[model samples]
Target: MEPDTLFVVGLALGVLSIPAVVSSVSRGERPRIATITLMIAGTMLVWAISNKPGGYSIEAIPAMVKRVLQGFT
Candidate 1:
């Protein structure tokens, strides 16, 4: 798999976990699952960033995601 793909997956997972964290906090419960998901997302993001030659630029993110998504079809 591509680093850009991993980056996208990590970002998506991190975004998805936000609601879970908020819900858990609102209910006075620990964000155990959300915390785990965040950890995984962080790891993937780190790995993807580190493995890339020149790293990533904010401007290239949209193109990267588009390429990754297009590869699936």
Candidate 2:
């Protein structure tokens, strides 16, 4: 699987589990379906809006005076 897909899937599953665990601790709910659902939805929302930009760019650096002097005849 692609890294992005893996990330989204993992995020969804992880978000889903948070609420389930929370409810289990408080009201003794076996499954916090509502909270988990909401969290998962939120994760998807963010992922949809934000994606990795393609390609890469390199930045040029200034030549140091020391290096320039060393190369002088």
Candidate 3:
């Protein structure tokens, strides 16, 4: 997959994991799964950012997301 796509997927996963982490904590359950998910997401995002040409800036994320979404349509 493209680095941008990977970054987007990782970002989405990381965002989704927030609810899982919250729910797990609220239920008093071990948050192992949620934690692992977050770790994996972080790794993917980091990998993508590191491998991307010219790297990326936080300010460019919105434009990157827009470009990626446009490609899907």
Q: lDDT by residue for model 3 over 1-73, one digit each (tens)? A: 8999889989999999999999999999988988999999999999998999899898999999999989999
TM-score of 3: 0.89
Model 3 residue 43 lDDT? Answer: 93
**Candidate 1's residue-wise lDDT over 1-73, tens digit each?**
6788899999999999999999999999999999999999999999999999999999998999888889889
* Winning model by lDDT: 1
lDDT of 2 by residue, 1-73 (tens): 3334433454556666776678777886666576666667666545633553441122211232233334443
* C-alpha RMSD of each candidate structure in angstroms: 0.8, 16.2, 1.1
Best by TM-score: 1
Which residue pairs overlap in candidate 1's backbone?
none
- Candidate 3: misplaced stretches above 4 Å? none
lDDT, candidate 3, at 70: 92
Alpha carbon lDDT of residue 69, candidate 2? 38
Error (Å) of candidate 3 at residue 43 is 1.1
Predictions ranked by lDDT, top down? Answer: 1, 3, 2
Among residues 3 or more apart in sequence or in different chains, the pairs in candidate 3 whose N, CA or C atoms overlap within 3 Å are: none
TM-score of each: 0.94, 0.37, 0.89
